[model samples]
Target: MKAAVASALRAARRVLAACHESPDGDCLGGALALCLALERAGKRVVVASTDGVPAVYRFLPAWERVTDRVEGLGSFDVAVALECADLERAGRFAPVLAACPVLVNLDHHRDNTGYGHLVWQDPQAASVCEMVYALLAELGAEVDEPVATCLMTGLLTDTGSFRYSSVRPETFELAAELVRRGARPDRIYELVYESRPPSAVRLLGLALSRLQLSADGRVAWSVVDEAMLQQAGARWEDTENIVETLRSIAGVRLALLFKVEPSRVKVSLRARDGARANEVAARFGGGGHLGAAGFVARGDLEDVVRQTLQAAAAEVQTGSG
Candidate 1:
């Protein structure tokens, strides 16, 4: 894998890098870190995301380099995708990625489709940023302040500030290296966790009011419709941490947050030790890590919620049995 990645990098001068749509911290951070590292290596690179950089991640170093449009993007020799399970997860940018002669998929998702020409899908990886750090080390790229700060953001967020089970000793080791290279944990905490907009806070209250638990108390869920978001003046990004709120409830082994969109319902799932959220999400044509996963389903809000809840409950029951 190292040889292949190195060869791909060496063979390409102009590189295009992208992450999945509605990118979370891991995807955004990994992309930013890789772009910066490649640039430092004297490679011309363009970073992109279908949703672009969220306001919360705007503080990330080189976040401004991410663009949403790739329609007229010129030809590139290699495209490196971070934290993307499949090409389609790139949304409208998938076609742009396909145009590349060489593609590298770097991800930690358990169900990555292995679609790229050179795939580095490590399910054991806590976050894509971790893998990117390893790659940078192997590629002899400079892990300067920009790279460290970007990679650390992914580590902090994907591990739930080191609270998730996916975090290992090696994860902290990598984090320490990043910190030594100039990543500031306190600043990241302030930007990501403490910088929530007032509208997001209001949305949280509204979402909590609709929280419901399954009869067994093994599953907890809440649905946030368009109207609820409008009332709260909240955007979809504002709901980022709300799923964690559901997962924190007593006796709830699985938590779900459903966001109703114009043509589909976006569902984020979080599960405890015995559950696999990725399995539940896969049933609806989505994929992610075992502890955290998500899917998008097209249907009426109520219907999608019912279907997702049923599948999640079934997954919990199956795991228990």
Candidate 2:
């Protein structure tokens, strides 16, 4: 699979690299790393992200190159969808990628839909950045300072600062190699984790204040509505990490966060070992890793929260049994 993707990329003169909608560090970092490497190899690369780069990830090299527009960019010889579970997960850029002659699906999600002409997926891999590192080696592209920094961003963020169970010995070895190639783990950590804006802090406080626990103490949840955003002067992106925070509570096996938008409620799910958060998310047409997943449902905030929490409670009950 690596050789196939490398061959396709080498053959293509113009390439489109796209990140999933509501992209996190893994998606943007891997896509940008690829873009930088491809540009060095003399290929014309355009990185697209419908939701654009979040402020926290703007420090990644070549992040400014990511554009939200797809029109008038012309067709590409190949299009690479990074960290997208399915083509539809590409969001607004889905049509553009589908129209490409060669579509490459590169992801680390367990529920990947297996779309695209060529796919390279590994559910066991810690992050797409890990796969991108291997792909660069397959293409014989240099993992220079800039490329290393971009890849490191994904590695650091996706592993939850090396706190997740997904981190393995190889993950650390890869991080060391990236550091030797000029990636600064300290700076990356500070920028991505420690440098939240004041508004984001305010939003986090609001979300925590609303945190609720199920009767059995196995399911935990919180809601972030438009009113909270307005009150805190924060954007929806500020809601990041709130679900993980919920999951950290003692005896809480399943945690959920419901973000009420104008048209839909976006629910983020996080669970400890043995709890299948993705299964719960799939009940609402969503998918993700066993420990982390999300879904979007169209309904009143209270209704969506009620339905999702019921499903989460049921999942916890089954896991405990």
Candidate 3:
């Protein structure tokens, strides 16, 4: 497994790590896991992105270490993009990505175009965190409490707390050990699921009010633009959980909740009853699991929403038939 993280790091002295913008569990987990591993190996490691670490994930030991400053940052030996596809996907780290001597891409996205000098894309691995797990093992580093916690965070989030089909026996077995080593599953569940801001509840209500049903009620959708966000005093974080509600509606196989931003449309796709949301997301340059996927559509909200809905419909029809 040394070859897994070898060819990339061997060519470098200092390294910078990054993940996709507006990161979810997998992206943050992957970035911190690798950052910890690289730092332990005596390499200078900087992990960064556009935003500060997401709120619930502040529990991670490495969460406070991330920075959002892009300009005038020092150069690096290798730049690793974790759970991300391209330079633009790196957000604030785009400059570092361009200046680095070598670029390493580590991701589980099937649609990733291998946007780096060294590419490690394994769609079958469930989560990039799994690969990072192997990398730490191969590095012969000790899996201390902090390391286990970071790894388990990615594992739990990507697997939906062991609810998704991606949860292999080994995944749970690894998780069990993480818990033993100090990954508080209960603490994480409470933070991720139990906590919701007031604006978020309002956004949820708005999304439910706007839920759109496609032919036969197989697909459900709701979109909130900047106007809605301004009116509701809501932020992007507030909208994250709202999408899952549409997906959970009875008999609705697909749910797409899009947040129309000023520059880009943030799309979240969720599915039930065996629909392939990942397949649909992939068609539009996104990557994720069959049950959950997303992408950014840069255009007028109406056009993007219509195109995405059409694509989702086609994917469901194709898969169902």
lDDT top scorer? 2
Off by over 4 Å in 1: 209-216, 222-231, 235-237, 256-269, 276-318
Superior by lDDT: candidate 1 or candidate 3: 1
Better of 2 and 3 by TM-score: 2
TM-score winner among the candidates? 2
Clashing residue pairs in candidate 3 (N, C-alpha, C atoms within 3 angstroms) = none
Write down the TM-score of every candidate: 0.83, 0.86, 0.79
lDDT of 3 by residue, 122-218 (tens): 7766777777877777767667778787888888788878887677777877888778888887877787777877787887888899889985788
The candidate with the higher lDDT, 1 or 2, is: 2
The regions of model 3 sitting more than 4 angstroms off are 1-4, 7-12, 209-214, 221-233, 256-269, 274-318
lDDT of 2 by residue, 222-287 (tens): 999889999999999789878889999999999999888889888999988588999999999999
Deviation of model 2 at 98, angstroms = 2.6
The lowest-lDDT stretch of 10 consecutive residues in candidate 3 is: 1-10
RMSD of 1: 3.4
